[model samples]
Target chain A: MATFSFAVMAVLPLFLMIFIGYFLRVFHVFKESFFNEVTRFCFKVAMPCLIFKNIYSSNLDVGSYVPLVVFGITGIISLAVIGCLFIPLTVKDQKKKGVMVQNLFRANFFFFGIPMITNIFGEEHIGPAVMMVAFVVPIFNILGAVVLAFFQEHEGKKRVDFKDILHNIFTNPIIIGAIIAFLFVLLKIPLFDFVVDVIGDIADVTTTIALISLGGTFKFQSAKHNMPYIIRGVLDKLFLVPAIMLTIAVILGFRGPELAICLALFGAPGAVASFVMAKEAGADGELAGQLIVFTTAFAFVSLVFFIFILRSLGFI
Target chain B: MASSFSFAFGAVLPIFMLVGLGYILRRLGYFPEAFVTLINKFCFEVALPALVFYNIYTSNTTIGQNSGLLIFGALAICGIAAVSLLILPKLVKESPRRAVLAQNMFRSNFILFGIPMAANMYGNDGVGPASILLAISAILYNILGTAIMAYYQEKQRSGKKSVHIVPLLKSIFKNHIIIGAALALVLLSLQIQLPNFLDRTVSDVAKVATPMGLMAVGAHFNFARAKADFRYLMIGLSGKLLIAPAIVMIIAIFCGFRGPLLGALLGMTASPGSITSYVVATSMDADGDLAGELVVFGTALSAFTMFGFIFLLRSLGFL
Candidate 1:
């Protein structure tokens, strides 16, 4: 019962936001030109400040999770290997192959993941979550990029360039912010607490605004075309994968919060990485778009079940 | 502190309002065909880079030891994602478009929405790690991501095989966000202090970034296009909300990840598609509409998925 209410609490606002945005558009409260200016304003000035503020104020730690890092990486490698075995057999077209690689393995570690978890668990759980992100992002970049490149390249055509992958990873804005933030933390440099406080305040406001924008962007029309892919994606990401992961967690003797975090993440929607990979690999960009929509929509069901399952096992 | 419900609702309000306005204007036929292009250019070239530069430059967090481990971990996660990308297409026997849809389903939105949440949750420490991950992804988005787009375009054009390095590098360097971030890093490394006036000026300019961005995002929201692109949108929704997160869990567990790292990693693993994908698609002339659909659908669906993940984690004591 508590879980059900919680689910409603979580879902209601999202729906409202989308509905409101859509309705406003339908009603013509403002001009289209205004949105462009707003997008420009956020993207150029505000977002960068937010990124700078976060990194400049934080302290970095290098050896925080050596064992965890190693284990996490190894696991990804194994999955990739297993996944690769199925790819060639399942997808004969090189173009299609590129798309497949992105779908199954990519993880959504940013937008929804960070905000949702932080809101639920507070700062204490942040350290572990942060550490995990550090480990997971690069593998997605290089390996994901390689797969994308490989599939994107015409059959019997030019060889894939390793340098391109490195370049892509190095130049990214988000990645750059991550690097600077890491450095600040590592050096143990002191920043003005007041500056951080200001940034924090701004961050709070920005987060809400970003969410609103996100809501406004939702479109239901596309769901119709993406049914089959949606079903498959949902099964793989929400059910099959999480079930396997929970079993592993239970077997490993991880109890309490540790177990909970692992299980919840396991059942999360597909990563946004697939979207990026699809675009990069020259797959069906529209199809990739729809897949993200479908899986996320169904995540609530999987999550609720997981919570019940965990509660039943006394993992909480 | 704001509760999750309040926080999310509050965050999303402005964008929706703006989108509503944009929609009305379109219906009224007040704008020319080039309006979208103009809006997109402003958001893409100017606003985005500035936002990125400010974010990277102003960070005061310290870099810790074992940074390499974080990098490695990200790589490993990517490795897993690569495999998923490879395999999912086969399981479903999807077309190239469907295959890409499957992959996008799994990726995260690290930029606009992801990083700020990291800051809010863990303060500097969390943001620092997220930044590293984002950087790695940036690199991938440009060279590797671009290469793939080129490959597909070539295939469609007649199975051509040549990869262009110059254009890829040019795009990366020419990107305002990347340039701004680079500048910030250089300034920070040199420990350059801004003059009081300049600092104030910078802050003032930065202040407008978010609200303006939200407004722009709202204004750009296209319901009609989404309706037209429904098929692609479905694929994106499923892949992002379902398959991606599941894959992350399997990979994280298999790799033996636990604790907060597991949660944070998974949280990120569940993000919707990024706005940048749209930008990249536009720049490459690949499929910006698909990118936009992914961003919109993924963002929307993520709420449910994210909530479920959070609730499950809390129930199991992770939260």
Candidate 2:
């Protein structure tokens, strides 16, 4: 009961904010221009600040958790590879394939993962969770950039621009944020308390505002056509991936907060960046949006079930 | 005496330097034109909202006690707006330029300058009153600025002399800054606490509003245009930095406002034209160059005017 309640407590605010966004859009409280401008702001500035702050604040004790780090990275890479191969078989649309493949691996770790972990395990135990973010965020960006660029649609056939891919990866604000944050941590450079506080404030709203923006731009018309893809994507992300990844982690003797963190990595909804990347790369942005909405909407159930099972097994 | 002068300098110089840094960065091609727009948009939609919300939410003072400040702020803004609307168009002769001039005259750079200046004078305790004033003033500025700009824009566009209230109201209501202020006020009044994580995140994001806004303002400065609009620019500068503030300060003082309250009011009246004025002017198809010029001149000259006001107020034992 406690775990269930915790799950609800964790996820309700996110959904509520998204709903407020949708409501505001319906009521014309915010215009399309407002959402577009805000989405760009989030993509460029807020998300980067969030990524940088998250990694910078985390204590990266890489040596102590080699196996967990190894398993986490291996899990993400394997999923990306499998997703790239498998998505083309199911999704006929060239643009959607990349978005599907990308989102299948890139969970909303920063937005959904970090908050849920903090809620369940307490903030003091968030070091491992933060460390997971340190590794996973860069991998997500690089993989996302490469995949989107590779599957970018063109009217006439043109080869993929490898230079564009590299540029995209390097110039990605979130990736840059992570790299800068990692350096800050490595160099032991102290950020002023106010600076961190300020970053935290910006980072704090990334999830809510991003969700709101997502809700504001959401198209129910597209959802009717994309229901199959949306359902499949949500199930794969929330259930299949976590089921496979957590089983492996458990078999490898992972348990408790570590297992929970790993579960979050595998189980959280698609990263909001997936939608942004899709839209920017001319991929199937609608599908990406649907996947984020559906996955985020139902992520609570998966989270509750996972937390309950882990707690019942006395692992968390 | 020297200490007070230095204190006044300490309060004002960092802000000036930041604006200068923004100008230099833009000149050196460090911050691209698009980057300036992005920074301003972020300031408008996210940072400024967060700043307002956080300040209002965390303030210890009740709204009841600060009703006086709120009333004084609303009246001051309405007074300025009324005066500007009644007189500026006749002087300027061109509708769009008049709209820009009137807006520049009435709308002070309160978010960037007012809050910080107040904080500099009286610390966090001062922020409550300053923030309340900011919220009221920002709403007024948007409503009045939007109406005036839209009216002139419609006149120019359709070659008709009628103001359309519906579209004007829509634009005013849709403003994110005003929405943010209204939300903050509601939450503050209800005594609702944002969760700790959310609170910290908001305050953190809010911290960027002032610096980013100042920087964006500096980046938007056009030196050539400033030269072109030299006469109009001087009118705007004198009105924004000198005349308008002097009037408001005298009124605030007569109303028994002293210390940080007077300082906050002075900051509101004396600061530069708001960046939003330029944004609205451009969006409304008004004279954006002139709007930008007014902002640049108002901001550039404000460092001296603000110093003068602060020093004078302090000398008079009002701050």
Candidate 3:
């Protein structure tokens, strides 16, 4: 019962902000262009600062990296491979296979999941979560590149350009941000106090702006057709994948903050970047958009429910 | 919280340092005006609102707590407007220019400057007083601005006086600044509690409001405008940036305002002339050239004046 209130207290406010964003849009308090620019700003400026700052401030144990890293690094790849192979059977359309594979495999761990951790469990526990984000981000990117590269192949770019994949992976804002922060941590780079303050301040702005941007970008003028694919996408991304991962983490004896972190990272909605990638790749962009919308819209209730259950069961 | 931490020099330094960074970056051609404009808009529409809302929602401050700041802020604004109205015509003979000068002298960029100053001084909770002052300033600025402009235009036309209350109220109703502050006030007054994550998110964004806003204000500085209509620019700026603030701060001092309350008043009175003066001037067919010059000159000169004023106030232990 105590944990029940804790669950609500931890989760509800972040989700309420999305509705506030929606209402702002509905009342015409904010325009669509603001949403587009804010989304870009979050992606380019705010999220990078946050990712960099989190990793920089974290205290990592070199010995402790054995279990969490091995699981994180290998886990994402296996999931991506399974998604690429399995999703194609159900999701026809060469275009959709790529985005579907992305939708299933790419969790919004950094944007939504990481903030949720700091909000619930505080920043001290973020060392492991940050490691997960650092390793998981690159894996997600490379997998996304490979999957999209395969699908875009059908559009008559016959050569599988290895150069393009490398460029795509290295140049991703999130990956670059993570890499830079990692380098700073490893080298013990000393920064001016005020500069650190500025970085820390901007880093903190990420979650609110991202959530509000999500609400603003949400399209109530959604498509009527292909409701099934959207439903399937939401379930696979929010429910099945998270359930399997949480159970696996539990069986592995992960508890407390680590268990909560797993639930959040695995349970988060599909990555917003997947939609951007899909649009750029010319693959079922509308479907990708809807998948982002529904999964995010539902993740609030689902994530809260999961937290409540886990807390009650004393599993986390 | 304010008792535990003295933000006197610590808070004031960050504002100017970021502003200096912005000015240097702008001068080096690294941050262009268009980029600063976008940043300004982002800060104004999205981030600043969240900043204000976060401060108001998270703090245990009530409307009654800030009634003094609200009353004094409104009174000081009206007093300035009255001075401008009574004195501007004698100083500037042209009808359109009369309205422009009055608006320039009366309006201050409290939103950009006030919130940041208060936030820096007293931290997040201090924003409650600052925001209430902001709402009062916005309301009075619009009312006085429209009436002053309409009064001049009416004189030029030799026609009946008219002030569009409905449209003015509607605009104020939808204003993003008021919306943010108002929503928080309503929620607070209703004894409502938002989710913790929401407040946490708001706090994160609020931390950004000052640095980005101050830097944008710095980048917005145009030294080239120093040569444009040099004499009148000085007149408008001196009155807006110096004389008006002096009058208000003196009155506030006599009223026993000190500490964070004094800090909030300093934000209200001592900041530069508002950027909106130009917009309102042009739209009202007033002397936009003079309005534009006053804003640029006032803001540019204000960086120096504000630093001095803040330094002086800190040394005097008023804030």
Top candidate by lDDT: 2
lDDT of 2 at B294: 74
TM-score of chain B of each: 0.73, 0.79, 0.64
Please write out the lDDT profile of model 3 over residues A1-316, one tens digit for every residue: 7777777766666676677678768878677766776677677666777777777877576467667567655666777789878988887778788888888778778666666776677877776776677677767777777787777745455455678777876887777888998898889998766666666766666677777777877886656786888888888888888888778888888788778767766788877778887887777888888888888888887788888888888886
Chain B, candidate 1: TM?
Answer: 0.73
Residue B81 C-alpha lDDT in model 2: 83
Which model, 1 or 3, shows the larger DockQ?
Answer: 3
In lDDT terms, how accurate is model 2?
Answer: 0.74
lDDT of 3 by residue, B214-242 (tens): 55556665556547567667678888778
Taking the tens digit of each residue's C-alpha lDDT, what string does model 1 give over B1-319?
Answer: 2454343433333334443444454455533335545545544554455555565566554447636536554664466456656765565442345334533643556654556555555567656666656655544443344445544444445544454666555655666556666776688789997654344333433443443333334445677877987866765676566666676666666666554455456556666665555555554456665665676566666666765665565566543
Question: Per-residue lDDT tens digits of candidate 2, residues B95-123?
Answer: 88888888888887786677877777788
Instruction: Tell me the TM-score of each prediction against the true structure.
Output: 0.46, 0.70, 0.76
lDDT of the candidates, in the order given:
0.55, 0.74, 0.72
Q: How accurate is candidate 1 locally (lDDT)?
A: 0.55
**Model 1 chain A weakest lDDT span, ten residues long:** A9-18
lDDT of 2 by residue, A1-316 (tens): 8766655555555555566567767877566666675677677767777777767886757687888889988899899899988889979989789988987899988666666776677666766776677677767877887788777776753566667766777787777787898889889999766567556655665655676676676555647888888888888999999989988988999987788888888998886678887887788888888888788878878877777777767777
lDDT of 1 by residue, A1-316 (tens): 7655544433333334334434544556424444444334333333434555554553334364454455456655655665667766755666656555566566554434444444344434545545455456678777676666666656654456778777876775455656666666767667655445444544444433343344344446656655655566568767877787667767766665455456545555655457756775667666666666666667657766775667666674
Better of 2 and 3 by lDDT: 2
CA RMSD, predictions in order: 27.5, 6.5, 5.7
